[model samples]
Target: MYSQEETLRSTIDKSLKVIRLYDWLLNLYVLDFFVDNHWTKLPLSWQECFQNITPQDLGNILSEVPTKHVLPLSFISLIKAVKSLSLPRDKISNKNKIGLLLSEDICNGHPRLKNLFLKHVKLKKRHEICLMSKVVSGVAVESKCDAVVDFGSGLGHLVRVLAYNNNLYAAGIECQSQLTEEARSVQLVHAYRAALERILVDYDPKLKHAPVRNIKHSDTMTFQQYSTQALSRLNIPLPACFARGEADLRQWRRVVTLYTLRLALAPLVETVILLDRVLYILEHGLSCEIHPVFDPKLSPRNHIIVGKRL
Candidate 1:
């Protein structure tokens, strides 16, 4: 078994390598994809690699192992390198994989109290709270934490489950008044349809139509049209770049490709953030371990840094 110091140091080293190698992708602003001329920033080889790529082609690149996808040799190599450098995200052990907790778990299985706390919670948030609460419960039990303090607790979801279901002393701090009051609240679809729609409408005046107030009928219209209408309702104007033809088909595709590349590095980026916390705790002579307590698909930011004072 590796010592805590050894594990953290090694993980930090790999994370830094990925960060340094793809600093450009990490730094690029997704919101400024059109304005920044981001395609010019990509390596010429990488630009050539993804220039003629299709939607399905980019999907294959995003997978864990691209067995059937045909990509340039360099792109394949980059993917492999990234995969090799990323920390393993699987559950640490069966010991850490505790069952999820709910109101029923703490409310003595009372049916009335079962889902009251979960009233406004979505499936993803429900899954996360159940899993993470159990993990935090375990860590608190192990360390005998005086009281668990949750930062950015927004609506106190996790802490609620932790304190009630797990019977641990917990407190939550939230800075956002909106979230404090009610702690609330993807996809590459058809070549950035919404972005394309905004640009196309400006590019061709004939497509323009009055904005609709309700987007509930989004299914009836193209995403671009729906988004344009929605934005119009809010009196938000499409960027001038779209009207100028600055962000055209080629730029859209490049932006998607660049975004996908950045997605590939997301795990490494998260690791760097989580491990930096671990390293800081270690510096202070506290024990720290990152637990992959939540499902990655359900909760992309699944790693939890648990610290214990030595």
Candidate 2:
């Protein structure tokens, strides 16, 4: 395992190189896909490379979120370029050194509080809160922290878990008043439900179980449908190239290929950001570590930046 300094230096070097190498791809706005004829920017060889790729193949690029993909022999050099520049997003185990310190087994949340607080949370969010609450609580306990302050505390899910489940004093700071109000509203529901449980012995079946199914775009969704849903969510209008009925299939394949390439670069970007934070802590003579506490496929931003002044 490399030391933190070694890891940080290596990551920064690679990140800079990657950003410089793909500066054009990185800077081009998705909104300008058709307006600027982004497809025309690709070299003819690159365009021809993606010509025969099918929509299902394009969907596979997204659905798998590939740690590794089987590339054609012809594209071996392309794979080499990406692999050499991209930081590996390998599943981190306790045996591996992500930071100087090792992570412990996450303590389970309080069962009663879990029932009260987890109703509105989605599956991915539930997974995150369940794991992250324990990690944050463990850090607070280790540092003998008087209170936990959560920044960007959307709906206060983690804060609630830390405060109620872990028996820690926790407060959430949210820049949006709507979310703050909603969190208060949710807190009341928890209080009311807890009161009901004591007085009426109420049982909520929904709280006990949640059903989940893995859906793949390649299996169930058409490429157009997938692209439409993605852009609609982001409030981006369909690019004119795609909006036309005779949209080139080659352009669609290129869009998927380029998007997957960007996704592959994400870990390098995250490493740069998290390490910068770690360096700031180290510079101040404080202890800091980044723990990969969540499943990366489920929570892409899985690394938790942990620091303590003591």
Candidate 3:
């Protein structure tokens, strides 16, 4: 129920908290805790510091991605906020939300797009794509741009909603070719299924009661062929760039260049990015709004940075 604006503001505050915590922890001789050194091998003070990590404290920090073996950003904030006189040195927190968007909110969006979501996506994915679509759509509307490029369009969820639901001309740029192909498959499947439904709806009344065993079986066999021929079978474009290679993440300066070249003169052109694993990116002459994008209880990493090219 949190407004996107509020989410932006609160999450920005939280992101700063995380940045502060990281800075604070670095000077505490906690760098040993960051490296390969074992707990027993660390200095006694370090051991005591970690030993203070209680079950409750652990719970608080665990809210970040545990699977990555990295400390949760919120936990970082928690550590800084609770720094003791017994141990000193540190500062920073860039509140970032961490979780997939949910389904119920998105499925109720565009009806046909919802069908694609329901048919092709998992629950977590459904939510993520749906929520992402909303965020991008809002920005796209304000930015007045028809083209959308999703940086790491994993599995094409965000791209799916963007292209089909939001009616944006979307292109998903992914590093992995296999995922790009898989996303194309999902897109083809939806198109094929939609084609079949149209046929069913147009079926003659005289044949309406005819056995659907063939129809059902045909659906099963269609995917087995998995042909590029599917393109000829329908007008629905596969929302992907099949042969597109990995992007040069090392060259971040291009983001600013892009804004200067295209977005600078526009009143509301914007730069939007997932502020995880990297700090927020900004172009000069632009304004940013940071928001807590998700229900915090579900994901502490829910902060988003929406920077308008003013």
Candidate 4:
């Protein structure tokens, strides 16, 4: 057992590595970053936010916006503020460091699931989860919750990790029909494959999922036999990663929104989206936390807000 102050000190130190950039904080308010040309992969939700912004609204915001000035947080200042804050001892204890490091038990468990699940998840998507896992696992453990709800869980990437890897009851709430359906399909395939392989191979049962050998399966003497048996028994459907069907590029663009391409080029909406998501979690009256997942220098999307039911 670690003292709360020890955990707080360590987490603050890790977050501080990039917290001084205070400039990154300021960028959150800059509107041009969202409209800038460098952003190429604007997410579906971002597209919605963009569409929601009226021309008149944008004009007024742009008119008053400075060429460059955004502000959010400072680690040192945070420490000073914490010292000055006169909150009750109970409340202070309740507010554990949001970014506690991942314990080996959760972070390193189910190595097979980590690798197998990533097969269908893209590289960039996997990278995001790697950063997310640190905070997610820490929050889940600290809050001691079995259920996790990912807000704006695009394509269910984080959901996949939580459910299959951590053996948690995780669900993603994505607004886009295409993205939600796609994630559901992918999860079904990944789960079926993992179930099949685990039963056939001798693995560490101490991990999250123990093998249920009695479940029906084909002989696994060879890959061909296993594959056939899996198909016949599981009848699993692969995700878009497995087969590329003819797609109307134009329609798909409209589905994801071509605005994504332009949005990525500028990436100004990122800070707004980040702050909005964090606030959205806090407002729900759950035990919520805000923590930096990785070094911001590596990926500005390193911070996250995790909420656990009280």
Candidate 5:
């Protein structure tokens, strides 16, 4: 019999296989971490080269067959080492921007389908959204709630995944224009493609049915419309009300000042969600659990937060 941890990992791995990009990303994430810790040291010239490349150019480079499989390991190690060095946040940000550009470039150089696959793939980070989603779903299943609301949704990825997987009526509140725009773009691309596919593909009893419906793309709408549209598209009755607003961390008694600086746009959220900070949620009438979804060891903040309305 497999341990719960092994079972969870197996489930995630199987799910990941369905999405080529996610599969590659998962492998890359592990490989990158391994290389960063144990592989060849990256030179200053290579670091400069990485900083200079754009996403499209990086995509092109990734498209070509690598001379050695071990090379990625060395490159990833260099990135980690650089991050470890005493550098200002701005410098790190610049480096990351270059890395993203490289990633995007590599993605673009791939086939259209592969590009689409990679588009949804994201680096594994300390995200509570997945755990929060599961908790919300479980609570809803028990209490028969109408919808789940995610506040301060960055790129709306969590909401998207929840609605897609659980057929839940969900809404996201996003304050950042850039992240909102990106989320909207992703939503449109996937929604439009799914709509087109449904129109073209005839129903077949032999094929497995797709679980998620096309999410309606709207800008700055009331929570009601968002929930209604998501439910209506899936031919489900609308929930009475959807969840709204971002999670609050202002109520936390003890929190780091650096957290405020990090979450300038959404300051009162760190203590409410961060792993080291999640105790506050429990104090504020929420339950906490560390579930296996992503690699937790990669970051201390990867667990999810589940709160029931008191």
Candidate 6:
């Protein structure tokens, strides 16, 4: 008979195996990094978080992990446990940093689900982003919009995807200086790589007919070029202008983590202003559409609001 601890350990081992297999297929480097740097270092609390996950939940996670699903289920249990303890804000200070770093790396590595970081909650599968983006784009087209604004643009993943793939004029509003700087840096790096690749493909005759490599390189190159142009045209000025006289916005509930709260507040404020602005545009007989993206998992509060003006 397996002891309770042994049972939990076995379950975790199996689940991790599945996760590793999935990561191997989609982005092995992420798996290597997680295993090498953080897997063993996970705190007891974190381990318990995974340990407590229901078998059914574990199975669901296993099924989706291989497909590169972006759902928050993997860590949702832990985040909830941490929130329940009413830990000091500083205790969980690194949570946002870890999440942001992980999501950013995942975005850079996975071409299929690059915008996973922008989502407030984790998604169950990669197709969810496609589904959500399609819905939002449809709403925008129906509204006949000229530009889209993505609030709380984590690593600017959604902005990059929409702008690069759809050729839409989009802007991402982020409050964290570190994240903003990183986003800008990623865009620059991707652009330079893309420019180099284009030069290579155009001049390297021996490698011109390598379809598989060429296609992969071309896709990345195209995405990078699109990202660079979109980022440049966005004109995202630093330290987004906030409402006057609200410097000590600390009055806002310090729930979850400061990073989480800050990310949350930016969109909430942006949504109110955006909705009103869109309403006014509609009232003025302007052709435009407003589409909002929301994440159901990261607390019922996760939301992404976009207003498109035709």
lDDT of 3: 0.42
TM-scores of the candidates are: 0.73, 0.64, 0.41, 0.33, 0.29, 0.25
Model 3 TM-score is 0.41
Model 2 spans > 4 angstroms off: 1-3, 55-114, 180-251
Candidate 3: where are CA atoms >4 Å away? 1-37, 41-115, 180-283
Q: Poorest 10 consecutive residues of model 5 by lDDT? A: 245-254
| Predicted model with the maximum lDDT | 1
- What candidate 5 gets wrong by more than 4 Å, as runs, is 1-120, 123-132, 180-293
Each model's Cα RMSD: 5.9, 15.2, 21.9, 20.6, 25.0, 23.7
Q: lDDT of candidate 1 vs native?
A: 0.66
Q: Which candidate ranks first by TM-score, i.e. highest?
A: 1
Q: Please, what is the whole-model Cα lDDT of each candidate in the order they appear?
A: 0.66, 0.56, 0.42, 0.44, 0.39, 0.39
Model 2 clashing residue pairs (backbone)? none
lDDT by residue (181-282, candidate 3, tens digit) is 543212311223333322333334342222222222244554323323433444433333121101221222322222221221121111112432113333
**Residue 78, model 5: Cα distance from true site in angstroms:** 28
Per-residue lDDT over 42-67 for candidate 1, one digit per residue giving the tens place of the 0 to 100 score: 87877877787875778766675354
Compose the digit string of candidate 5's lDDT tens values, residues 1-310. Answer: 9844444344444333333322222232211221132111324444444433444444444434343323345445433332333111122222123233223333224455444333554554213444445556787887678688888876666676467656788899987777534444334222222222222222332322333444555556544454455435454333421221111122111112112212221211222224333444545665544433333333333334455555
Residue-by-residue lDDT tens digits, candidate 2, 144-239: 875888899988888876776678888998887775344322121121112222211112333221211222344555444644543343333434
**Which has the better lDDT: candidate 4, or candidate 5?**
4
113-196 in candidate 4: lDDT tens per residue? 555555676544555575576457677788787888888987676787777667788988878767535432222122233433
Instruction: Report the error of model 1 at residue 253, Å.
Output: 3.1
